[model samples]
Structure formats: C-alpha cells, structure tokens
Target: MISTQLLFGQLLLGLINGSFYALMSLGLAVIFGMINVVNFAHGAQYMLGAFAAWLLLHYAGIGFWPALILVPALVGLIGMAIERTMLKRLYKVDHLYGLLLTFGLALIIEGGFTHVYGSSGQQYPVPAALAGGWNLGFMFLPIYRAFVVAASLMLCLGTWLVIEKTRLGAYLRAATENPALVQAFGVNVPVLMMLTYGGGVALAGLAGVLAAPIYQVNPLMGSNLVIIVFAVVVIGGLGSIMGAIVSGYVLGLCEGFAKVFYPEASNIVVFVIMAIVLLVRPSGLFGKGD
Candidate 1:
C-alpha cells in the first residue's frame, strides 16, 4: 500500500504534468481551430524550444528568466517560417494531407536532433533562484515545482482571457469562423493565420523549456508525451481551450490516483477516460458538431 505522503507526492507530479499537458493541448486547439492544421509536429517544436533554451544557457550563459522569454520567441519565429514555407501550401488541400506532411516533418525533426544531439539526453538544472523546497505538514513541496504550477496556471489563464475577451481575440475568433468575411473588412487573413500558428508553436516551446529542468532534455521527449496529450485533447474536446485545461488536470489527477491503488492502470487510465468521453460525446466535451 502506498503511504499518504507518497500518494500526495505522486499527485503533485501529476498536477505538474497536467499543467504542461493543458498548455500544449490549448495551443494545439488554438492553432487547429483558427488555422485548420492538425500540427503533428507540435511535439518536435516543443522539443526544439527546450533545446533552444539549453543551448542559450549552456553556451551564452543565459539564465532561466531570459531563456523563458527568448526561447518562445525563437520557436515562434521558426513556426512562422514553417507555416509560410510549407504549411501554407496545404491550406486548400484535404487536412489529412496536412496531417501526413506534419507527421513527416516531425520525423525529420526528431531524426535530425537524434543525429546531431545523439540518443543520449541532456540535463537542465533548475536555476539557483528556484532551487529550494517548502515544508508542508504532510510533505515537502519543491519550490521550483510550485513555481511551475503557478506559472502554468497564470499562462493558461492569460491565454484564456485573450481568447475570450480582447479585441485581437475578437478578430481571431471572427477569423476562425470565416476568414473571407474578416478579410473583406481589410483584415489580413493569411497573416493572422500565420501569427496564430506561430503563437501556438511558441506555447509548445515554452512548455518544453519549463519541462527541461524536471525532465531530461531529449529528442523523443515530445513524441512520448504527445500521444498522451492527444488523448487529453480528445477527452477535453478539440477547439475548446477551457475544456482542454480542465480535462488535462482532471485526467492527470486521475492517473496519479491510479498509480497508488492500481499501478498497472496508471498507464492506461487516460486512454480509458478518453474512450469513454468519445462514446458519450462524439464531438468531445468542448467540440462542436458539424
């Protein structure tokens, strides 16, 4: 039987993992909902973000704060380049083709990283500023983990607000519904689409940088988590930002509980929930019917 402390510890880890899952899925939703691409290469883009931060820190002595700011920008720029050069070509084609193209792109990215960085992983130490712990009556909480949780929450909330409330967000939502109509108002539909895609990719990259200190910086890291993220996205209902965030955390906690009572189930619990959600709501918890 697992001790209470261990259970809480696992729960904390689950929440941390969930936070990233939510962030990534939310980004995916934003991109797909507005830009109409499946973004199979999101995982690779995330890995690139972490790698970028690591390189900046190791070679240029950039610290966590700077890395946190700069890495996303770099990743976003790369995303824009990809969208402009490759993804834009598939806008009018069947989205399945876009998915296939991105899958191939993901493979190319992972393969390139593995060839250059090797199969071995690299470490990203938590900054001195965040290297500490807080004592709770039941268990000690790592300061860095707390920071991560807080940061993730704030970021998610900010994204939600932007999408639900601001003028730019209004334009984004309008564009998602009918780009041609929005463009008739003289709004540049293509540019907005590219920007949204870039922003979504940047979010993935930011998550990667945040995760590096907790998990090793490796080529396959994104691929490994991405499948599960898809499960989260499906369960939460694609194109529903709020649903993605809430479901990600709920499923993460569920998985954490499973680890205690039934270790074997921990691995598949998310999938089970996903399957159930699909059965009950074909459009997902947050998706709209065609």
Candidate 2:
C-alpha cells in the first residue's frame, strides 16, 4: 500500500505541473479565440523567458524576483512585434499559414538557442527565500512548489476575471465574435488583436519563469511540454478558457496517480486521457458542441 505521504506528494507534484499546463493552455486558448491563429511559437517564447531570466542573472546580477517581472514583459513585447510585423500579414490567409509560420519561427528560435547554449540543461538555483520545504508530519513539501501552485492559481484566476468580468474583456469578447462589427463600433480591433497575441505569449513567458528553477533551463524543454499542453488544450476543449484551466489540473492529477500505480505508463497517460476525451466529447470537456 502506498503511504499517505507518498500519495499526497505525487498529488502535489501533479498540481504543480498542472499549474504550468493551465497557464500555457490559457495562452493558447486566448490566441486562438482572438486572432484565429494557433501560436506554435508559444513554446519558443517560453524558452525565451527562461533564457531571459538566466541572462539577467548572469549578466545583469539580477535575480528571480526581478526576472519574474521583467522577463514576461520583454517576451510580451517580442510577441507583439512578431504579431505586428509578421503574423499580421497572414490574418487574411488560412490559419494553416499562421501555424506553419509560427512553427518555422519555433524551429529558428530553438536552433539558434541550441547553437549558442548547446543541448545541455542549465541549472537555475531556486530563490534563496524559497529554497526550503515544509514538513507536515506525513510529507515534506517544498516551499517553492507551494509558491508555484499558489501563484499559478492566482494568475489564472486573475486572468479569468479580467476576461470575463471587465469592460475590456467585453470588448475583447465582442471583437472575437465579430472584429469588423467591433471595429465599426470604434474599437481598435487590429491593435486589440496584437495585444491579445502579446498577452497570450506573455502568459507562456510567465510559465517559463516559474518553471526555471524546477526544470533545467534548456532549448528543448518547451517542445515536449508544449505538445502535452496542446493535448491539455484539446482535452479541455479548444477555445474554452474554463475548460483549459480545469482540464489541466485534472489531467495533471491523473498523470500523477498513474505514475504511482503504473510507473511505466506515466508518460503516455495524458495522451491516453486525451484520446478518451476526444472520443467521448469531440468538442472537449468545456467546449460547446457544434
């Protein structure tokens, strides 16, 4: 029998992983909803954020706290520029073009990083303040992991509130439904699209920053993770914000439990769940049926 401590520990780790999944999926959902573009470069942007944080620490003598704030902003700016200069031109074209362009961009970014940094993973020290753990009789909980969970939940909830409960969110929703109509109402739909793209990539960047200490900073880090996130997005239902959030956590926990019971199948558990979900509900857990 698995000890309670062991079970709970895996569950906690699952929740932490879920947090990142939720964040990345949220960004994907946002981009798809607003710009009608699937951002294959999102994983690259996430890698950029991790690298940005590392660069800041090595060259500028900055640390995690500052990087948490600055890295996402920098990435978001890069995303905005990409949208304005390159992605903007493809809006009138098929979404496949957008996907191909971003996939190409991902290859370029990852190749460049691999050339410069090599394939080895770089260690990012946990912040001094979060370097310890809490012992709760049954289990030892890493303080940093706890922080990741709390911070991710807050960020996810804040984003949801902004999108669902605010005037700006109303405009965004309106624009998503019919950009031309929104434009006729005097909203700057084009700029909004750019910003929405920026925001989505920014979320990816933020997740990267959070993941740095937990996972080694490496160019290929985001590639496999992004694939899993895409599965999460699909399982949650494409373009369903709440579905993405809930499915991320649910699937993460499922993966965690799978690891405990059938260690060999852990890696494929999420994909299995995704397949089942697809079969049962083609529209996703949270998505509306066509």
Candidate 3:
C-alpha cells in the first residue's frame, strides 16, 4: 500500500511542476491568441530570462528579488524589438513562416548559449527569506515552492481578469477580430499587437525567474521543457487562457497520481491524456467551438 505521506509529497511536487507548466503555456496561449504567432522561441526566451538573472547576479551583484522584477521587463523589451523588426513582416503571410522564423531563433539562441556556457547547468540559490520549509504532520513543505504556486495562481488569475473583464481586453479582442476597423478608430493596432507580444514574452520570463531556483539554469533547460509545455498548450486549447491554466494543473495531478499507482506510466501519462483530449475534443476543454 502507498503511504499517505508519499502520496502527498508526490502531489505537492506535481503541483509545483504544474505551476511551471501553467505559467509557460499561458505565455504561449497569449502570444498565439493575440498575435497569431506560434512562438517556437518561447523556450529560448525562458532560458534567456534565467540567464539574465544569473548574469545580473554574478556580474552586477543584483539579487533574486530585483531580478524577479527586472528580468521580465528586460526580456519583454527584447521580444518587442523582435516583433517590431521581424515578426511584423510575417503577420500577413502563412503561419508556418512565423513558426519557422521563431524555431530558427530558438535554435540560434540555444546554440549561442551552449557555445558560451557549455551544456552544463548553473545553480541559482534560493532567496534568503524563502530558504526553508515547514514540516507539516504529513510532510515537509518548502516555502519557496508554496510561494511559487501562490504567485503563479495569482498571476494567471490576474491575466484572465485583465483579458476578460477590462476595456483593454475588449480592445485587444476587437483588434484581433478586426484590426482594420480598430485601426480606423485610431487605436494604433500595430503598436497594440507588438505590446501584446511583449507581454506574452514577459510571462515566459517570469516563469523562468520562478523556475531558476528549482531547476538548473542552462541553455537547454527551456528546450527540454518547452515540448511538454507545448503539449499542455495544445491539450488546453491553442488560445484559451483558462484552458492552459486548468489543463496544466489537471495533467500535473494526473502525473502525480500515476506515479503512486503505476510508476512506469508516470512519464507517458501526460502525453496519453493529451492524445485522448485531442481525439475527443480538439478545441480543448475550455476552448470555444467553431
């Protein structure tokens, strides 16, 4: 029989993993939905965020707290530059072109980092304030892990609210559906689209900051995780924010429970579920029907 403590520990770990998945896939959803970009470079951007944090710390003596705030903004600006310089030209063409462009960027970024840093990983220390854990009766809960879950949940909720309940969101949706009409109203649709892409890239950077302490900071880290994140995005619906958030957690829980029940299937459980979801409901659980 499985121990309750073991199950709870596994579940907690699953929740942590889910948090990352949700955050990463949420960025993918926003970019794809708002700008119609597949963003194959999202993983690379995530790696860049972590690397930026590491660089700021080791070189400039900046710490985690400041990096938490600065890295996203810095990376977001880089993304905005890319959108303005390159992505703008592809919007009117086939999506495959955008995908190809992003995928190429991902390869270049990853390769550049690999050449500089090699394939080995660097460790990001846990912040001093969140360096410990609480020992519950059942299991020890790490404070940083708990904070990660809470922060990610709040961010996801906040993003959903802003996208669904505000005038800015309405404008975004309207612009998506009819950019020419919005442009005619003096909305500057091009700038809006660029900012939206920047926002999406910022989300990925934030996730990287959150993940640096938990995972190794390496050139290939994003490349390793992005496939799973992409699966999460696909299972959740391509552009559905809620779908990404909910599917991420559900799949995490599924993987956790699978580990306890059938260790052999833990890795494949998520992919299996993704396949089933795709087969049953291609639009995803929270996505709108065509």
Candidate 4:
C-alpha cells in the first residue's frame, strides 16, 4: 500500500517530468503538422540549447536568467538557418529522405559534441531565486521544479494560443491546410514555414534550459529524453498539439506510479502503453488518419 505522502511526491515529480515531455512533444507536433518533417534533429537542438546556456554562464559570465533568453534566441536563429539551407531542399522529396537527413544531422551533432566535450556530464546551478523548497505537510518540493512546471505550462498555453486564437494562428492553420491557396492570398508560406520550424526548435531549446539544473548537461541528455518524448507524442497523437500536452503529463504520472508499484517495469511501462494505444487506435487518440 502506497502512503498518501509518497503518492503526492511522485505526482509532483511526474508533473515536473511531464512539463518537459509536453513542451518538447508539443514542439515536435507543431513542426510536423506544418511541414510533415520528422525533425529527428530536435533532440540535438535541445542539447545545443543547454550547451549554449552552459557556455554563456561559464565563459561569458552571463547568468542563468540572461542565458535562458539568449540561448533560445540563438538556437532558434540556427534552426531557421538550417530550415532555409537544408530542409527547404527536401520539401519535395520523400519524407523518408527527410527523416534520413535529420537522423544524419543528429548523428553529426552528437558526434561533434562528443568529440569536443567528451561524454561526461556537466552541472548547472539553480538560480538563487529558485534555490529552495516549499515544505508541505508531508513533503518538500523544490522551488526550481515548481518554477519549471509553471513556466512550461505557461509556454505551452502560449503556443496553443498562438496557433488557435490570433491572426498569425489563422494564417498558420490556413497554410497547413493548403499552402498554395494561402500563398495565393498574398501570404508568404515559405517564410512562415521557416519561422514555425525555428520556433518549434526554440521551444525544445527552452526545455533543455529548464532541464539543465535538474539533469546533468550532456550530449546524450536530449537524445535519451527525445525517445521518451516521441513515445509520448505517439501515444498522444501525431500533429495534435493539445493531445501531445495532455498525453505527456498523463503518461508521466503513470510512469511515476509504476516506479513506486513495480519498479522493474518502470522503464518499459511507457513503451508498453504506447504499443497498446497503437493497437487500439493507430492514428492515436487525437490524430486524424492520414
């Protein structure tokens, strides 16, 4: 029998991990929804964000707060560059080719980082403002984790608003349905496409920054998490923003519970759930059949 205190603590941890999973998976869904690219390099891009933050703090004497803003901007700009120079060329090709290209890019990035940084992890300190915990009746919750949950949730809501409520959102939705038709209406679909991709990647970068304090900063960090995120996305639904967010958190909580009840199955629990979901609804809970 699980104690209420332990259950509550695990729920909090689950929500914390869910924030990252949801943020990353939502970004992936947005990118895939617009461009139909697999974006295999997303994990590498996320890792780059952490590395950027680490660099700014260590070499440039920049603080975490500044790096939090600057790193995502820098990484977003890099993503835009990649989309224009490399991704654009593959637009007319088979999606498999695009996936292959991104996979290769992921390899290149991981290899480059491994060459320079070696495989060992680096630490990032929690900012002074967030370096404490709130004591509840039965447990203490780290302030940074709470901050991460709040910030990530806000960003996710903001992204949803941008895609669903605003004029830009209208254009994006229209463009996704029929790029040629939207382009005929005097909108520059290509530019919007590039920006969307960059923004999605930038979100991943932001997740990395948020994660740096909790997890060791390393090349493998993003790659490892990305798989679980992919599973989350799959279980949620491809290209469904709301679904991605909901599924990420739900699955994260489930994983946390599994850890407490059947520790041995925790590792495979997510994948097992994904397989079951796939068997039941191949298009996923919120996905439209392609």
Q: Candidate 4 regions off by >4 Å?
A: none
Query: What lDDT tens digits, residue by residue, belong to model 2 across residues 104-178?
Result: 999999999999999899988999999999999988999999999999888888888988899998999999888
Q: Cα-based RMSD of the predictions, in order?
A: 1.1, 0.9, 0.9, 1.1
Clashes of each: 0, 0, 0, 0
Q: Candidate 3, which segments miss by more than 4 Å at Cα? A: none
lDDT of each: 0.90, 0.91, 0.92, 0.90
* Colliding pairs, model 4: none
In model 1, the number of clashes is 0
- Pairs that collide, model 1: none
**Clashing residue pairs in candidate 2 (N, C-alpha, C atoms within 3 angstroms):** none
Error of 4 at 23 (Å): 0.5
TM-score on alpha carbons, each prediction: 0.98, 0.98, 0.98, 0.97
RMSD of 4: 1.1
- Tell me the deviation in Å of residue 58 in model 4: 0.2
